[model samples]
Target: MLGCLLAADGTAQAAVSESVFLDEMPVVLSVSRLSQPINEAPAAVTVIDRDMIRASGFRDIPDLLRLVPGFSVAYTRDNTWAVGYHGLADAFSRRFQVLVDGRSIYSPHFGAVLWSDLPVAIEDIERIEVVRGPNAAMYGSNAFLAVINIITQSAAQAAGGLVSVQYGEQGMAGLLARYGGGDADRRWRVTLSTQDRDRFEDTGPDGSGNPVELRERTHTYFLSGRTDWQIDPRNDMSLQWGVSQGDWRGGRVGEASEPARRESGAAFVHLQFHRIPTPGREWRGQIYYTRNHYDADALGTIPGWPLPVRVDDHLVQTRLNLDIQSIQRLRDGLRAVWGVEWRRETVESPQNYFNQGTLDGELARLHGNLEWRVTNAWLVQGGAMVEHHYYTGTDISPRLAVNYTPLAGQTLRANISRAYRSPTFFEQDGNLVYTDTGNNAVNVVTIPAGSLLKPERLLSREVGYVGQFKPLGLEVNAKLFYDTLYDYLGSQKLNTAQCNEPGAKKCFQSVNGSSLNLRGWETELHWRPLPHLDVSAHYARVRIDYEAIVLDVTSTIIDDDLPDSAPRNTFGLLARYGWDAGWQASAGIYQTDSITWLSDGDKTTGYTRVDARLARRFKWQGYGAELALVAQSIGNTYSEFRQENLFGPKVYASLALDW
Candidate 1:
């Protein structure tokens, strides 16, 4: 119904009548693999709809996550971002899983989401569902911290032609064109977009209190299309394909070592067949293939250095997946969903792996969820996943949740889950040794993958509440959690007989050396007064307590700063209103405490950011048209990711037309 209302505009909208009812609470599927209202789900979920997306004035989909509680989002570079949940923010530790239309996009090379290369346009998204806890019991491995499910509008829902253009500060320029058409039985939509942006004014501190500069400007292009076909009364099919490529300028003023062009791209093709034979029975089969490639090496002769052999980043990653699932009613007031998945992931790199040609991993998993209703106000959910991976032979993840309703619009929830994440390929078998241009060893060995690594384990427990205030049109979702992370994958300095250097004689390898206790509370508040006004707010507080399982690994103690990964407090508020004459205005306030990024990231100071936007809709040749002006970070300049990476005010205007 929300999708229908958003797609209708005003002409075909739902009539304003007493017979019509709108649900303030959302129904989500990412929780227990079942479609249930938030009050009944086992996890805390945050839904970002199209209305908020448009009003936020964010050009990148990642920036829109500021509205979600306990989410830390920052830009490490002009073309790269670090996104984390609760704690453990990093550029390489891709702990969480992201799904686009049920297709996982987690890369196999460095275990990171290729944010800059995502083949998705901001405007093409319909909604995003974020599950704010470990969901490995249903999503398999790598869904360690959370799961983000990005749902795009169907071809049928977006049947028209649209063109939008944007130009903003930092030399930001973009253009998008979309066309969609179909009949009742079949529909398809295609979107093509390109964005060109310049690097930030400052690229971070280069030590000596001096600013460092590299041409990190980027130009990106994307082409995404979707097709929906209704084969018969009981069958349907969907085809989704997307391609993206980006070129980033990279060079230093006096150095020839930085790669002149940083290249990154991704492509994917997905096909799914769905069957619904009865009202309470359904099944789906899907297959997908994805490829991601990147080339950005920094190697040049320095003024005082004699060697210019810096084996920088260059890699290719691919994934092929097949899955089948069934959802059905087991009995009265009872439901179940079962599924199986098989996948192959491969990574090819000469720099990181040295002589290793291609590294491959095969994985298979079986998962199931059951929902039982004991009474009119009591619901019990349980699920587990049995998975087999080349890295971790076989493992079982289990989850259980209980929900009780005390009144008409209030519910209480208690949940506990156990999950695991295997060490990434880079952490397992990587031989990351850089050599000189003459193939001679120029640097000492570090992080040599010496010791065997154990898969990280997690035990999470949470108590939550969901409430709806009918008279005030308000809905609240909140949770308090205590999680224990065991077998932490930290690096330990080890004695190596390889190239001996006076400055660095020891190498490092992954080890289970540290443990952590995460305590946090997060909440969401949303209120919408139909037709004119909408308000959304979020807040969270997190504290990480670190403990060492063993600090006697050699002499150095690593990962002690892991407890500083997240801030102590964060909050945000956004409000939008519509007035007469098709005029609309919106404002947002965001705040976060100081945070320290992990693995080469710097500790950044806390800052407050304010944004506002104004727009008006009109008819151009009888076609809907809108012009909007947005101002971001109207406050003073602040640092992000690094102290020298300054973030300043920006203003931009966009014109969107539907024909």
Candidate 2:
């Protein structure tokens, strides 16, 4: 549920008319691509509303995800972050899908979301809906594990000029400005923001394994605009565009890290149209274009090389996607929704692809879901998606769910689903080679892709219970899930016959080499005991088992690291209160058990984080203004992803004004 409403029209519908507890349950639109209440949806979901966003006092979108159950977040460096669900996650969150206003933002080059340069600002988001299990039947490939949908506020809500500025320790500073204006039929808004901060005081060492000190820091800027128009009584449309750019100072060209300076940028344009043919029917279409660019230049010395090597890491990625969907009522108790989608992804990189020219791929999908109320106490939902990809041919993902309601404010749900994840271009066409001044391959980082790669598949089963107590003003959601993954992609050293390329030596290939299984239970509680107070808490327990482990002498996939990548227990708590007429206070506490990060990450011990925020909201000089003070990580230094990177106490102050 999104802490918002979603009527049959499906475009963030206004509040409902009835006031019963069941009728007032939070509504959601991401599950099954249909508008329904939380208890009636097929899967478990977590919603982060605007109020929680402000109370958490987090500037990074990934950092704010700590509130979600069964999620793990790590800071790999100044510009890199890793987020995963269940387990088996590296620097790239390959199995997860993320969207902003129905536009997918997954990168084709690295198989991950570019968190450092996301196009939208947190202040502009209305809410985030996170589906906790496989949802490929509604979304497409790469929705193998979870889905995160970020919905921004409508243009009409941002109808005034607003400004915010902040300063903090460790070179933390930021500024943001927004303005909006329109008439009854048309509305528009624009946002501009910039920020700079330091990530680590000193990087442990360079590639050569020598004692060294390097400061890692980053600076960023973003601009975005949105427009909404109500052309007529039954039609409306929206247009949105944004661009974000950032620069990070990093370590030299070491084995694990690269570049002294890295520049990253992202841009996107999204347009959507909606039509309401009748009171119970609607059609919507969306088209989006997105691009990502990266550039890095550095010089380094290999252990046995005679001369320095020039490292030029440059990459450009682009995506064009379009989709249309329709929802109509067939009868009194039955409704159906269907959609079609197409997308193209392209990548250009000489350094990474080893002289391979620009590469591109295409994908097409068709999907439909039916929701039928069998009786007053029983509801059933089923859907399937068929997708054709340039690499993996065609595949189908399907889901079936059942919901039972014995009483008005209580519901029981069960779901079973299957999903697939196509192999990324990096996994298929990787050719990493280090060249010296003489143009000779000095270090064979990797050879090339294997021709026999296949898509990874997942099977998810879950049972859940949700209940809302109107008198207590409390909500409880709990679930138990079991998941299995097959044909898992892993790396291995290939022999002469196993090498797909002729005359290839010491080939490092990607293969369908392993399987994984996970079982877990998680719970979330939302309590608003008083009119001026809000409290939320969550807990998760996970157990991971490896059916097969891929081992390569030259690879980093160790036996223990694969099974210990996920924490066994996780907990979080959040609280907000209005202490006085103009005073507000909030606090959050989070803890994670010991776990190991795969690929470039390291083993870390259990850690706990605490944060507090105090603010005063009032009207000054005929303008809405707020002054806030925040304290974060109020404890001893703790490691994030690596032992070298430490987190400590920090304080910041900010002022926001609206006119």
Candidate 3:
């Protein structure tokens, strides 16, 4: 595989550099900095462009993420998915942060992301930047493991009409349509899409039995527009707005219930001003506002039992940046960014289901960062953030990093940072009832208000190396990282009868206790061995350990095994061939090691699964088109998340047209 990639690299470099080399290509976005070249950034940043998305023929964001190093996707149901990265899995993956055009996508209620809700259109996405490390100083909380930023294309690039349709196994159907065009100077766009899938019967390891049934349906609509006004020779102002809505359905376990539905949406508006301060200095300022909402119905319950809940949230932020060169010396420069932000949220729960509650709260933060170039080959960056929450206590985070470029196309980088995760309302004052065999009874769990719940802190360190050779047309990047968590927030069971009357039943409290350690390594390689062929592959491994603790004075230590949801190893590979006649063909595969879930002292064995896709593109008259064939679960592996089950099946073909 490596030899094939290296040969293709030499051919591709000779073909592109000789004809299409451009000096002003926009550098992809990075988590360590606002935006910087992939090699210049002091972190491991992965970029998946729109062309790659189309060639892969992936159906959604979760599918596309399989190609990224150190990432895995686990499905809870037909329409719900959990993403794990850098050794952290679901329910425990609070360390990662996700954003879409600078707007937060991580759910504050559960501290996890529902990948299906993110509005990702293959045509609208410009690129996805995946950064592996702690970025709390630049992105605030929930950035201890990694950061994923999805950036959309400018309106100018989407000024046309396009339509696509797909159908496959289990009565699955998908439809998408988009149209937009404006004056040469101003542009706008709109898109509408819907997907529906009939439930499939689940099977056991041997693939035969009466399995559970699962089904799902979803519909989404989006509208956005942008305009640029050239006010002067040195200044230009731009305005943009976007809105989307989604509806979903599915099933629950151990009960007969109607499909649960949820609706979520967001609106954003931003204004920016740029000016030249001096001969080689520049400054930019921006202000924006965002609003989000989520509503869901209870899982399984009697008809008309009243099971509905809603969350409303709003955020306002302002940022300023300055770039100066030769301020004090000929080779020294300074780059600084600072900002302030505020957020308000409200929740309404009427059914008292699923940890329902009614609460309103606000939070504010001040953050800034500065980068300095001490020498031609050495660079340093430092930053800090201070945040205050209405219910949770204040927190301060700091970060430092360095980059050394010993030679052209060869770079080494390292980073050290301190980050934190604030306690959620559900962890502070909510009440829940849970059943445990160890306690031999149903226990009511309640967290007391006004109790000290310190923010979960992490001290992280990373080292990486990246090399790009023009002659070989190959790019290789590798990194290793470790993190130690203090005061990690986790649930613990207590015996209420010990303090109360002997006749009372035992109860437990979901309180904060114990610590955890996580470490991992990731590698990504890109090679264009031939002018018509390209190959890319990624591999990652992670491990996690939670300290032992005594519950109810039994002096029992929690198991040392990692979380059940995190996979120890994951890997993916893609091969593509592009022809001069607009003909394209590609095939790819993704595999994940089995996962183990522990319950009642029982450990489950893990399994592995595979998927593949093939596609072709062509143009006729004034329209461009593509057709693809996809087969998911090529090995037909059976898997389950919690009580929900899934079976791998084949998805047939899809056709797309654009003008």
Using all chains and alpha carbons, the TM-scores for the candidates as numbered come to 0.93, 0.93, 0.81
Q: Is candidate 1 or 3 superior in TM-score?
A: 1
Candidate 3 stretches greater than 4 Å from native? 1-26, 91-93, 198-210, 217-245, 253-332, 351-357, 432-450, 494-509, 554-565, 596-609, 640-644
Q: Which stretches of candidate 2 lie over 4 Å from their true place?
A: 1-23, 203-214, 252-257, 493-507, 550-560
lDDT of 2: 0.81
TM-score ranking from best candidate downward: 2, 1, 3
lDDT of 1 by residue, 567-588 (tens): 9999999999998988999999
Overall local distance difference test of candidate 1: 0.79
Clashing pairs in 2: none
TM-score of 1: 0.93
Collision pairs in model 1: 257-299, 257-300
lDDT of each residue in 1-659, candidate 3, tens digit only: 00000011111112113222133222544454434556666567787877678767677776688789877665555355656675445533456777664556565555556465555566677667777777777666777667777766555556789898888877677888878777744556676776655433442321344454444556656565555444444444445566667666555443333335666665666544444445444344444444456565433332343432122111122212111111111234677656666666544432212244456567777776677887878888788878777666588889888988888778888888898877655555444433222222133434342376777788988898888877877888888888888876655544565323222244334445577777788898888889888888898887777755665573233333445445678788877787776677776777677665322112223445455566767886778988888777676655544433555666768988999
Predicted model with the maximum lDDT: 2
